[model samples]
Target: MNSSDSLKLVVKQQNLEDISHYIYAIVYPIVFLLGIVGNLLSSLLFSVTKLNRTSCGVYFLLLAVFDTIALIGGLHHCLNIGYRVAIPNATYCRARVFLVYVSMDMTSWMIVAISVDRYLKVKYPITARIYATQKLAMIVSSIIMIIFIVKNVHLATVFIGDFSSNAADNCDANPLYPKYVAFFHNVWPWIDLTTYALFPFLIVTICNAFIIHDQYKRRVKLRKRNLDRSLITLLLVSSISLILCNLPITILAGVYTHISTSTNTND
Candidate 1:
């Protein structure tokens, strides 16, 4: 392209980025406020009230805590994009990225745990009574935390801060670890797809489907309202909303990954 055309293209891209930054500046505070308020109320209801007595409630409490953490992690992005506050160094980048991943993984898997709990409680009341105890919920939540922490620990070492400018895209994988660089580019996207979206989506969808079918049959046979109607409705809404919100981003990431992979192969 000619110099004028290239200059115009650059200016257009810069304009788009500026627009996005302004959008983030506006939207993020609203999300942070709403998320914090909602999660705090949820935490209070689950922890201080009788809701905390159940396994489902235990999962929710943990979800609230982790979701809050995830939201806080997002502040870095807001600061970077909106305020031009660059990540200071490698340590900050690593810690920020690590916390974000761990918290997000916890939130995603916690939903799966809740869905499974609901499934068991619905399909096998007797068996669920035995297995779906608060203690079991604690244990399962702990295991999920431990697993995600271990899985994402490499983030602490892998990412390095780029100090060239006050741009939002600051962290990059350490070039010293070629294997990790390859994994980060070529493999990590799929892993994220499975962990963050696909696996949870499949599990929650299947479990909820079974729960819904069973509930329908029971309602037809007994002609009574579902005992756990409120709780079930809450789970259904959360699961559906989670999937819907994540779907667009998930598909976009998958497409980007595929295109990137093809480009690398052609190179």
Candidate 2:
């Protein structure tokens, strides 16, 4: 394509990207507010009521905390897009990415924990009673949080800020950190895809599948089946939303990367 054609193409691509950003700028704040209210109420209920004494209730309580945090990340995203709040330094850039990823990661894996807790309760009641105590849940959650933070600690040093006076782009990873800069750039996107989206989806899907199977085998009463309806609905909605929302973006990103690589190779 000629220069004019190239400029048009660039404009078209920006339009596509900005369209989604625009929608998110408007929609994310609403979602953030609603999430804050819902999670706060849940936190209050789970804390004060008899629910706080149980293993599952503790998970819900923790989930509420993490969900609120993740929503804060969403709010910052809107502000960045709408107001052009530039990343001032490396620490700021790294901290922003770290905050969003840590909370979101914790939230996603905690859902899996909750899923497995329910599955074990249904599939092996005796074992669940023996093992799935409030103490165990607390221990597992602590372990998960520790492991997640350690695993992602590199993130704080990875992001580089825009020092330019008229910067237009968001923060990005520091290319100098990796010996093979090209390889690092190529693989960075997969981190969020796998950790935040893919693994969580798989964990939730597998646990719920077994839970449903176990429920089917037992002579479960109508009332008994409906007892955990609200929790189940929340799980279903969250899991499905995470998978559906992230999966398409992940696949498109992968495809785009592949095409770009092929074009570069040919050139």
Point to the candidate with the largest TM-score: 1
The sequence of per-residue lDDT tens digits that candidate 2 reaches over residues 55-128 is 89889999899989878866655665543344446666677667766787788887888888888887888989
- Show where candidate 2 strays beyond 4 Å: 3-8, 158-170, 178-184, 219-239, 245-267
- Residue pairs with colliding backbones in model 2 are none
Residue 183, model 2: lDDT of 41
lDDT of 1: 0.76
Worst-scoring 10-residue span by lDDT in model 1: 258-267
RMSD after Cα superposition, model 2: 5.9
